[model samples]
Target: MSTYSNDVFLVGTLYGQSAVSVSQILSGAGANVSSTALLGAVLNEYNARLNDPAVQNAADWYSSYRLPTHQEIIENYNEVAALSPTEQLAIGKLGKLTSYPVMIDLGPGNVQLFTAIGLLNDYKARYPNSDPLNLKSYENDYSALAADLTDTFSDTTVKFAGLMVQKGTEWGSNNVANWNDLSQAEKNAFAVFFYKVGENEMNARLESAGGNYVPDLAGAPIAQEFYSNIEGIDSAVVNSFGSWWSNALGSEQGFAEAQKLEYYADFFEQNPEAFSTNPMFLNHLISEVGHDGLRQLANVFDWPLCFAEGTLISLGDGTQIPIEDVRIGDVVTSYESTLPLGRLQNKRVTRLFKNEVAHLLDVHGLKVTPGHVTLCGDGQFAGKHVPIIDILLSDGALVRENGDLIRMAINKPVGSREDQFVQVSYAVDADAAREGNLQSGKMRVGTLLFDRDDQPVSVLDCIQAEGMTFNPKTGLVTRAGGSPEPLYFFGELPRPEDYILRRSRETLEGILTDGEWEGTPSQLVGQRLRQTYSLKLH
Candidate 1:
């Protein structure tokens, strides 16, 4: 919605005459008046002048003045009926001037008359001290009157405007004469009147059968003008009107969604690495901007991210290959350090269907393969050759043994030790073997000395083990014939608390290096992640 200022006038003329002259002329315009009591008083004056005979030609002007026809009167009544409740009340207050108690006869079967009477009674009850007989008093108490009318009316705009006027402190009009000279109370009164008129007219158009109540982009200026001219109205009230107007025009939701998209765009500009470390962040980003919006943001920021079925990664040696095309023993440059070129040492694909990388690393020991793992050109892990059994037992990677994949005991604490010795076979797929297409090297594994089951065990536990000999290909434990040997098995591996901390630090560093960010560093990665991924609202 747009904002605007009210136009103020210092002096004004009516019908090419001064205010006093116009008021005097209107006071004597008997034919223009609609009050029955005023008409009767005029007739009484005419009769008195005729009987005196000294007042010659007094009846001449009265004779030429014709009362409005019944049809015209009915039309006028209908016009009043069509007016907003605030306007109707304003006009009703004017009826008191002629000492004529005008009954709002809405014809037969119309309950509007009763409804208006009930509302007026309630209004009088609320403001018992307010004068109902005087027009100036009525004008002064317009806020209360408008509030009552608004409560009694079905029209939402009138209800809204009435609420604003009641809550507002100052009011004025562009059409009022000597606006600056008017007292605060008078100005407020004028503001209430002006609002009633404008609201009535605007509501008429808005409530019409084919009204343009819901504003589009083009209607923003109109909304701005309408809302801005109302002095002292709450900003929230103005926004509510704009929301209603836009909803009526069928643009509110669309505009809001567009605003979210713009917000995400700005977020990406401010925080770049947020998308790299946290993959789930993409879900929220996708929801706000949609696939196309994500694509647009990615392009604008040169984000090395993709959500396709397959991904192609570039090696440090400038070799670009699809992840699916990568095979065991194939050398790839490492992204861990830029100074010295590092080769892919270990490679393993532990398929994760719905698991988060962080959760897997923290709860379960992550397997370190012989080859490095690079994500979006960032080195996630430097390859290091480790036995398959060591990878399964130490790194907590799922192991395939005896035609069954051995799942990690995720519930077990990292430093916890278990005395149970579970036996399993070790099998390697064709892609995972050193040379062959497929290989099966089975071994029997048993726990000799295990860590306690209460706490997480660390690499220190493995270093402290004594008198244990096991085959790397097949986890087979051997003891010298008839020799008494003491062997210990480490229970759950050490929790990757340090690794997690390092990853968090790296994520922040990536964020700082990704964009033109000059802000102070923050440890609030989750907060930054939420801001970066969530929709931006206006």
Candidate 2:
């Protein structure tokens, strides 16, 4: 028989003949000790499992594994968790109704029995005194209860399962293998099944099963978007973003009310040409001007680009101090010629930075020689080169504009120069990378990062989040969320259709930057706020 059938049988027999060998072992001190209750627990669990639509549909395909004894479910978790990341992914996608069940520690009680108790508790919470096994059938011949939730697991469930599976693999010695062998459909199936485990059912599976799957403190079920009819914003996203923003507005001066109006007014007049090219600017302007302006801006862009909160350190020659530690009047290194690294071979600063001269001066500091550095003036890349007393960072290092010493990360060759102007290569934390459409490899300058409700967040704030990287010169942001993995940035201008969404995002960002904003109910801010005010420009 298949491994599934074999394992199921091993555990199933424990339920079918409650008083047999399975019972003996269960009652033995060496086993779970709740032997007598195994049969009844299994029956309840089996009935509960049947209530799941996926389980019901999957039953016929893998009937041999269905209705296994309570003991079998626990055992299967161990085997599934033991699969390679590749196989785990496969199993996660295509294992029929397989889901990572929740585990609960019930102190001194029989862990297995307590596990069943947890599942029953969950059923009670959802059905509220109603029996899961006795739900009324619906027109589709399925229960309305089943229709209430998506068959695919919620985001919380998915993240929780990932934590358990990854942790279990870490604690246990499991071989890593090429799980990619599974077809795409199979991988998708695993994700769907892995997440479908109910919060309570998960607790039961863990307690009863001898498997190891502990939940994290942060992994507790967050209401997220479970209740509200908000699009684009959920609790998870809101909580993280709101917490970050409320803390950020307190320190950021640019967010002050007066500064915001000037920032936008100057931004619009100076960037009128770019208004068509960069929709984010328009969106922010509209948000500041109110309704009609919001609509106008929405007409121009396609996605929201906001700054996230975080620190950005760029590697530069000693002339520039890292932006995080910049002090007034700090001398920075203007430029330094170093031996060619990989891409720098045979290329000078001129050829490397390319048409990027404008961005270079505006965003980075320069180092010319040892012990001497100076910051570039604002909009230096736009052909108005003015040195500032402040320090700057580029690439991945910390330095001072006074040409003082600090540490530095490796730097790549990527900048350009023309006539009297020179633009040098620099790195950007992913949080600060430009957000725009992508074409070849080049990206247009724009905002990036959004709040929980799909509203734009500040790039500065995003930098604080783990795993954000930005290449100031390259203008790229690399992000991996869910199974949808892609390096997104503002590579090119978006199509007309996307401009409205983009503009709305800009308006929300402007509003946040303008107010000394603090966290509010995310569902309300993201969902209700958007619906009521049409804050989304589009």
Candidate 3:
């Protein structure tokens, strides 16, 4: 039988709204089933599940498990699906709560103190005999009962925002005070303004994350990297981020529009270092900005960090070399530094990969990816190398205009991480691989597609290779060659505690007869459906 004939494609189509559905994964083709039947089966199954609120995202690639009774039928192939070491490590470090029922999520739940307080006070006045922070009340309200409630942020939330936002000069200096000097309302103002823009996601991680933090889940480490990049690039630019606030009490408008989440919409378009778009951050932005608003942002969206063929990698120093001419071990100028007599430092590149994007941002003839691998250039975060799409709030690169930071998104056209005009892509980031020091490398153009399978990868040497496929968006898996029906097997992820705790140790102890992790991140979408929507799947 041909690879496409007998090969099985296990398909799961439980994606959220605006998600990829029916991309086609047909696994069942009994001897009696025709090619038309197989096609119809896949389409019929997808249409049946089209409205199933429980549809999962397509990015999950967890290992699989074969039922004991059916294990002997299929031969030669391994008993379970396989996972890469990096993917294994990613699960342990990056995994967190995916589904919630109005419960407090310390991640995006961290709100500005002022907003929290104001909302709390409002809630209290509405219901004098109630607890303002009650989770049950919120759950009821979510179900359309009566009590209105919301999540809580660690009081420590927004303190970092205060510190990061500073009045660079007399321009906003008289009005804005250093974090310590800021009054109560001013502190709330900072938090209010920050949250108004959108979830910076990084605030919680960088604020409470202790010293032992490592490379974490998608978009987690972005805040630290963004802060580092702006600080390294120029102190004055850092000031521009907050110069607009000017002691003004924050409202829906009039905050530091400089680092606004609007600009990073472009960064989201590229999906940064993510294999596909970061689902968690993507969902959050959609909730706040809406699809049309995000679609309308033309700013930094035009500038993909990916450079075109034959572009030279610019060093912090004056020298420039053809990017392809640079090798893995070579050192390049990354970013600016003020210590040791104020000079730029050279750093080594550790990991390199091919990446792709639909469009490239040309800022004054300097082409690059927008917000991709910003982590590498800005080493304030944990990781070998990566760009934090939800940095602190989709970390941005701004230019000073009228002494205020202009959102880097200006004058950009919208694009997609899914587009494929050119493929010779390679990602260059400021990385700290093997190098203990921070600010390790520079952001250079490169390639990584948000595709599940070998979706047309272009090599720098102008070669193309067939590669395995998995979509990060929906945890969808497919193959042209594999055992037929009843032959498909998958490792089901255990409960949160089990996989996160015991499985990690078991993998280290060689107890993983099957695999280290079992479930896909996309499974959480179903979990979310069960809890929030009162929906039933099985």
Candidate 4:
């Protein structure tokens, strides 16, 4: 089945007043809000709910009136169902309390507990305090209640069952499996998010639950490869995924197989040295730590380095001494916060020698090979930096502002793993990078598009490929394929220019790079070309 199934209930609710419901937004946006700003909103709401004298009274009565059985909780829910949805959610707290007590009796395992913890934290974040309800008093009561549930149940399943009973309408819809306590990778690949929480507590109650903390799936090795290409993850932590999968999968061999097996499958499929090359693994490693995770890890490790210093730069593994000396898989935080900066913003030091020549190729304008890796280029405007990476073509040419063809030289070799520091260098003049100089060879043009499976699409010899483009603002170019065609090239094609072009042309220009390279001290000739010819598809 296509991964794009329409199941609102499985995804959770559209709580409160927002421009649009949670379901309407793309998953990337959804995950961002859910994990960031919305987390604060939910926490505030839950605190307010607890403060309401009516809910407190009700909770107090329910707690005192002989622990309600699972059946009794259901009947209470039925009664609440007759009320408005808002009323039902209010009265639902009573059911939530009862459910946890029973879950304790059941003694459930990791999966069950994991789910429960997420629910409880969600609840707490939604209902911060019982108000004019002394925050402290409510906190004390919440803590006691949480302790009671934790103490009585002993097994975490009690909380899981409670989550189902209370928030079943939202969570129950997802095809959540028990996972048999598998690896963090399995849970993440499967989209199983869980956290633990006490029945009640205040002050950082939203933190990950005890024994309930699963290795962040975003941190798993599998996620580094597949998901990183498509989704951004917390890059502030080198994935020490904890014991979630190890304990669940059981046996050292099982853990190793779970982690490495998927990778081995790819190795066999693409037997080229790409699998063993340091850059190949560094790509995966970058995926593993991600800019965000690495930043966070750096914060955790208290590294002195920061990613927001200036322009976004790429340092090949072991090439960046100051950065690599710290750790290969560690995540460094941005200067301001402890959160990860994500991969695009994150740089891995592949080489570390000073006085090293760096080339920033504007792939969008010139011909590029089928597999050239681009990095952040030097140029700053409006307080942000842009991408500058070494183009694979030895002799590529680029276009200049006067439209003159400038000969491009290869400052650095493609996929060269030597001891050197490539600084923030601008791509040779666009015309230079496109065509060949006396020293460098001819430049080739390439196309970017995903194949049938939605993998990153890169095609060389795209000088004649038919395509389409669209414009939402003008409604022009609204024909069929939605991507414009009849593209032109300037020089020797660099390897893998499509993705780099697509990313740079779309998000980096504004969305991701924040227009840092637009009209900067070092004008980006390639970006200039994209603005002139390339049309937006998304």
Candidate 5:
């Protein structure tokens, strides 16, 4: 009956009369979701919430128009490559459940709640002294009265369901005082409006009828705790509950997660704008929550903040080990901006993405990815990083061959500046032209371009990637894998690096002024060590 805009598919195999849909329907089922076996388990509990599944938008899930019958999901699935940004968020991260237009109509039960409430109020007015509590059980004359109200379509299943909604709605509307204002007996009177409302025969009815509902549900007295458990789960809340199931047919021991997120639920419920800005905030911090709140939940943060292979990862014991050698449960020195000296904490590794990056830079003697964040100084926002190459070419970064300091203003001649300062530019067509690599009409129009500072500009070095953009959110650069950096010399095809340097006095002058680096290709000898590293011309 509901026409969902984002038409979510439940493409799954039928296990006899039972059906098992894809796990993307649930939040907390991360991208690394392995085993359709887990899907079965998730759906088992999900289907158990048979009556009212999700609270609208409460649970997390990835919804899409068409379902891929990609059998790859049976064992492994990283097919986020083909998903929309919203669907990607649902799959790639945890805690970020997306909402679709899945809704409940409530059918006959919609106005039934108000009707029951009105009937109870009229009865109270007729018999002024007969308290509602007196009719708590179907005993004596009350039995006949309760039977009159109990029918197939009404409160036979969930006894007092409408009455509880009535009392809650009325109490809030009429009384100045809240639930805390109610006396103990008065609170018990409201409790009398909520009960189990079903019997063991109801389960048998579901099996025999082969349908969703049970008509003649036998009544049973509910425990005191059951009222509190089902508290506040009205139509709105029930709708929310119904939505999350389809949203992320998803996580964890129920009690443990409930206890952990109890305080969080309170805070976020009040301050919803925190999530309204960036819905992924909680999803991003989910690892931190696991580490801080529940150690059993496996803390793993995919830190794009990487270190080079040989770099040292300091241990809490004051000893150092290579970054690759570090293991989970090892207390490593993790920095907190509040403390000048960082504190040591145990960190666990969740994922390890192999980055054989083309743009590698040598920071001092350490080899690091140009994208690495540790290259930047502290206090910078995450991902706001400067390439290591930028720092090395700066004035203070480079020393003269005689060990003397020199200001390296790229705009001026190579070796002349008052104080140690340098300027850099994104335009580097001159660098390529000086080498005579800029063939006919290849100056600016023939090559790839980038939007620097919102203005279109060229990169100093050419990227082997196909797509180029200032911000990756729009068009992520994907390398078309051939050579990382093609070799050029004397404007010849695939020549050695033996040409170009004269006109580009701005960028190259720092190294050329010092005259400490080479200006020609390496000889085909045993090994040509270039600046403590091998320069294999491809």
Candidate 6:
């Protein structure tokens, strides 16, 4: 008899009647009975109970009819196994609802019977036009299909069940012989799947399934052709490609090698010209070295430049010396005038307490070069002095020509080449002093001082007799009216008797006039007396 009839008989015996009763029923039905005829009695009893309104309770109805039991469900499942693989696949798909089943009023046993029958019927239906190799359903519900296959196969080969379920419907194989037999479209679809799943996960899945499918697929001509033209692949891109290769090969080492090949291919594709010029070096750079190495290589083609502060130089002769050894009064070669050969006669070493000199120079675009002389003017005399040009405002003193002060403003333009003719003083050496026995340690030629109007004042006229009031603050001198003509001394202190008489007379008169002096005469007399007193003290 057909497996179907055997399954039905087994089912009937388990639920419909005792084995002896089933035998009697079969005998009364007669030998060589059709499978349908053998099940007729049980089917009729089941139908009658299901149609009866008085049998409203599902459990009561099922119990009275003695419907198919768990054994019958197993038999039905076995019958499904007997179907062709294609048919089984169709049934699997049909039974594989996307969601859980809704509860119904049917008794549990009746429900089980109906479920078994439903499975059997689905298995019996004609296979659909779906392309199993495309694996659309399996891909959509991989977890469900895996579980279902494991449940149905009764073996540990469920790992490769996804491949078995594909078109051509093969079983018990872990090779790509079946994969090769698929249509081009199906092959392409598989490649897409492999690319999406990546190397590690795909390799793991294939290894679990006990398949050499990874290497076979990765080495395929289609895969090679697809990856041949990839470019601009950095580390991140390499990792992704590595993953894809790993998924295809199920081997990390194999993926790494393949990734290197792809990287070189991309490099070559992007720099065809570079390859022509220096293929060996380029290959070494791209393959054996990293970004920093490439940067070092690039630096070989660049040209070099730098600037630093220079040493102190002598103004008298161009001799370089350490800056720390420089002292005040040391003469330095002039930077102010190239025409007259001016020199820095005075050098002042100022200790800076605040601000950075280098920063200040940079800010003002000033440079400290040898023989640099900053010209300073005060009244009639202009001097060549070397003032420490720095940010510390209090460190350097202004230039002094004769006794007049020249003030240097902070915002003054530096490094200016404008020249001002001024007198320069040099230190007298002991040898020179002994040789000449000079009256003054130093000699002066240019105008030494000036009046308030900036007019040159005679150095000779500056020296006067005593009782002549000399205001150093205003650089002015006055004498009492009708006093003896003031004695003049060239570079010497004046005498007191020549200008002291008028002042003495005015003092005596003021004492007689209630100790008061009036008008211009009084004012003159008072100023003279004050001067006489000042001279006396001096």
Top-lDDT candidate index:
1
Candidate 4 global CA lDDT score: 0.29
Best by TM-score: 5
Q: Which tens-of-lDDT digit does each residue in 1-538 have in candidate 3?
A: 0111100111101111101111111111101111222122222222232333122111111111111111211221121113333332233212312211111111112222223333334444644664422422432222111011110111122121211221111112332325455543333233333332222232333335542222221242222222222221121122322322222224444433343354345345544322223333334344444544433442334312245556687554567787757665677765343432123467775423344543333433444442343322211222212322211122232322112222222211112222112211122222432333222121111122213453422111121133323332332323456322111111221121221122122221132222111111111222222343342332
Clashing pairs in 6: 199-243, 199-246, 199-247, 315-332, 315-333, 335-371
Model 6: ten consecutive residues of lowest lDDT: 515-524
Each prediction's total of clashing residue pairs, residues at least 3 apart in sequence or on different chains, is 26, 84, 55, 105, 17, 6
Question: Arrange candidates by lDDT, highest first: which order?
Answer: 1, 6, 4, 5, 2, 3
* Candidate 3 least-lDDT 10 residues: 5-14
| Winner on TM-score (5 vs 6) | 5
CA lDDT for candidate 2? 0.28
How big is the positional error of residue 511 in model 4, measured in Å on the Cα after superposition?
A: 20
Per-residue CA lDDT of model 2 for 463-489, tens digit only, reads 326375444543444444533222343
TM-score of 5: 0.24
TM-score computed on alpha carbons, candidate 4: 0.19
- lDDT of the candidates, in the order given: 0.31, 0.28, 0.27, 0.29, 0.28, 0.30
lDDT per residue as tens, model 5, 335-367: 443433222344444323233323333333455
For all predicted structures, in order, the TM-scores are 0.22, 0.17, 0.21, 0.19, 0.24, 0.13
Candidate 1: where is the Cα deviation over 4 Å?
Answer: 1-253, 256-260, 271-284, 302-321, 324-395, 398-478, 488-538
Candidate 3 lDDT at 465 equals 32
- TM-score pick, better of 2 and 5: 5
Error of 5 at 295 (Å): 12
For residues 440-515, could you state the per-residue lDDT of candidate 1 as single tens digits?
2321122222246534443223423533344333334445443322232222212212233232233422432232
lDDT of 6 at 502: 25
Sort by TM-score, best first: 5, 1, 3, 4, 2, 6
